[model samples]
Structures are given as C-alpha cells and as structure tokens.
Target chain A: MKYKAKVFVTLRPSVLDPAGTAVQSALTQMSYNVESVRIGKYVEMVLDATDESEASDRLHQACDQLLANPVIENYRFELVEAL
Target chain B: MKYKAKVFVTLRPSVLDPAGTAVQSALTQMSYNVESVRIGKYVEMVLDATDESEASDRLHQACDQLLANPVIENYRFELVEAL
Candidate 1:
C-alpha cells in the first residue's frame, strides 16, 4: 500500500520573515487593514512507505534533508490514505 | 495588538485532487518513483485580533468564508507572534 503526506514548514518563533513583512506592508498600504504577515513553505509528497510508521519515517527524512530548514523553521505534517 | 495565523486547507477524505495527481504523475515519470499523490492549499494571514481568542475567531471566519472550500477541504491552523 502507499500513503501521502502534506508537510508544512515555517519560520521559528524568533526568526524574522522579511517577505511576509513586505507583503503585510503592501496589504496594509492597499487598505486591507492587515496587522502582521508571516510567510512559510508548503509541500505535498507521495511516498513509498507501506504503513503509517514507515511513512512517518520516510516523511521525516524528506523533511530533514530536503523539505525544510530545521535551523530556522519548525515543521509539522499529516499523513493519510492517498485515495 | 496583532496576530499571525497560518491556515492549511486540504481536500477532504473523499475529494480527488487532480492537480496533485498531475504533479505526482510527472514526478513518477521523471524517475522519482513516487507512489500516490494528494494536494492541499496553504494560506498565511495577518489579522487584527487583540488576543488569542479573538484571533482564533477571526481565523476561523476567514477560513470558513474565504480561505477554504468547506465542502471539499478540511482546514487546520496555528497562530503565533508575528515578530
């Protein structure tokens, strides 16, 4: 069997998000009444793991090596049946 | 004074994600050896809520009315200090 996971990786609490800041500023300037802005990365992956544990492990590897920057961003995810 | 929320809205258990399917097909064709494919939406919003409770309420409203297709996707979120 196969599984799918959606991984969300975001800037840690202490990091400054300049892109989000700039976007928020633009939105506010446009009269959107925005207060603050945050920018994060989104990734969806389909893996070869057959069960939930293996899927989680492979997903973690993907996140650790290529999907996210552990130095500055915190990551979370959800795993579910692909179909 | 301000708050930041990251909203992730994904296809519900039964909805098919064609875009994600196409992307996964491409990956497999490229020798990525992928299994199944699923796709979801990611949104980041900066709101004017003064406290956590209000922020949650505003975020929920945003997700309900504008951020997600409630009929097909389930939404999840996290809130944190912007800076």
Candidate 2:
C-alpha cells in the first residue's frame, strides 16, 4: 500500500529564526498589527509500506533521521491517506 | 485593514536538498515504494496594509527581499481574506 504523509518541521522555540524575525519586522513597518508570525517547513511524501503501522514507524524514523534536526527543530507528521 | 498571506517558499527544482534526499533514501530502505518527495517552507503573515493591492505588493517585496532567497528558492503567496 502507498501512504501519504504531511510533515511539518519547525525550529524549536528556543532557536532563533532570523527569517521569521525579519518578516515580522517588515510587517510592523507595513503598519500591520500582526498577531503572530511563524515559518516552518512542509514536506509531502508518498511511501509504499506494508501497513499503516509500518508506514507510521518508517515515517517517524525518517523524520528523526533526516526530515528534522532534533537539536534545534521539532517535527510532526500526519498520515493523510492510504492509496 | 489587516490582510493575511500564506507564503510557500521552495527550493528551485535545480537546487539539491540534501535533507529531502536523505529522507528519500531512508524511505527506500524502509521498503516504501516512494512516489515523490518535496520539502518547502510555509510562512503565514498578517500584514496591515491600506488595501489588497498594497498588501500584495508589500508581500511581494518582502518575499523578494527576505522571505525567500531568489538565488535558490522560489516563493508564492496566497492572500487570504482581510481581517
């Protein structure tokens, strides 16, 4: 079966996101009473696994090993659907 | 008025994404007959602009200036409803 996943990887709260900060500054200057600004990554992957459990496990491993940097970022994955 | 924008910044197809490539390799090892994999950044910005045109123009400027690295990344923005 093929499984589709949406992974969101973001810098941890303690880490500095210069890109996000710069955008926030620009918004302020543009006269926007901004609520909040966050920048993160969205990754979509289509994988072939035996079952949902296996797919989930493998996807988690991928996220830990490559999709995100555990040292400075946190990651989450949503198994969208089976194909 | 306040306007919201969702910016998606992605590496041009030409640039190599080591992180995404690594994940693809891991997925193959996991026996996932992968379809495709792409990784990109999603940014949500709330801006205060006089109108839609101004908001869009400013957002475009922001994307070119800092939200994305034109050299390696391409960015697209969706203007959400006004607030």
Candidate 3:
C-alpha cells in the first residue's frame, strides 16, 4: 500500500526562533496587524507500507530519527492512504 | 473572535529546491526508502476576526502580501476558531 505523510516540524516553545522573529518584523513593516509569526518546516512524502498502522509507525520513526531534532524541535504527522 | 491559521508555503513544482534535495539525500543515507522528499514552510498564527470567513480572508491576504513569494512559491491555509 502507498501512504502519504504530512509532517510538521517546529521549534520547541522555549527555544528562540530568529527566523520567526524576522518574519514577524517584516509582516509588521508591511502593515499587517499580526501578533506573532512562527516559521517551521512542512514535509510531504509518499511511502510504501503493509497497512495503515505500519505506515503510521514508520512516519513516526522517520520524524524522530531524521525529520526533526529531538532537543530543539518537535514534530507531528498525519498519514492517509494515497491513490 | 479569535482564530488560528495553519499556512503551508511550498516552492512551485518548476522551481529548484536545494534544501529539499539535501534532505532527500540525508533520508536516503539513513536507510529510509523514499521516492522523493519535498520540504516547505509551515506557519501558525492566531488572530482576531469577526467570523471564520473574515479570518480566512485575512490569512489569504497575509500569505499573498508577505508570507509567500507568489512568483516562485505557492501557499494554502486552513483556519479554525480558537478557544
């Protein structure tokens, strides 16, 4: 079976995010009344698996092992069967 | 009312993404069998709005005016009422 995973990688709340701050500043300069801006990584991938459960497990493993840095980053993913 | 917006910004298919390429190579090195990997930006923000439709409009405007470069990047967003 084929599955698609949408992974979101974000910095831990306690960590400083310079990129986010820069973006916020830019938005403010552009006259957008936004309170805050956060920048993170979104990854989409298709993978082979035996079943939905197996695909979920593999996606979690991928996020933990490669997609996100455990110390400073956190990740969440959603998986769906792909055509 | 308060609303939350999840924005995804990705390079157009025709554009070159070196960062995506580097991550794809890293994933391959880690022994993950993946067809391809695409990396993009994810942004989350909370804003004040009169209703869902207004929130959606503001999110779209934000993306078009600042969050994404329409020439090379494309964006999509989802909005939900915040508790």
Q: Which candidate achieves the best TM-score against the true structure?
A: 3
Sort order, TM-score high to low? 3, 2, 1
| Residue A35 miss distance in model 1 (angstroms) | 2.1
Q: Model 2 interface RMSD, in angstroms?
A: 2.9
Candidate 2 docks at the CAPRI level of acceptable
By lDDT, who's the top model here? 3
User: Considering lDDT, where higher is better, how would the candidates rank from best to worst?
Assistant: 3, 2, 1
DockQ of 1: 0.29
| TM-score of chain B taken alone, every candidate | 0.92, 0.89, 0.94
User: How many backbone clashes are present in model 1?
Assistant: 0
lDDT value, candidate 3, whole model: 0.85
**Number of the top DockQ candidate:** 3
Q: Write the per-residue lDDT of candidate 1 for residues B11-67, one digit (tens) a residue.
A: 886998787677667666654446766566566776775688887876776567655
* Candidate 1 per-residue C-alpha lDDT over A14-73 given as tens digits, one digit per residue, 9 for 90 to 100: 999887787667656654556656667566776776578887876776667655688998
lDDT of 1 at A59: 73
User: Whose lDDT is higher: candidate 1's or candidate 2's?
Assistant: 2
Cα RMSD of all models vs. native, in order, equals: 5.3, 4.1, 1.6
| TM-score against native, each model | 0.60, 0.65, 0.91
- Cα lDDT, model 2, residue A27: 66
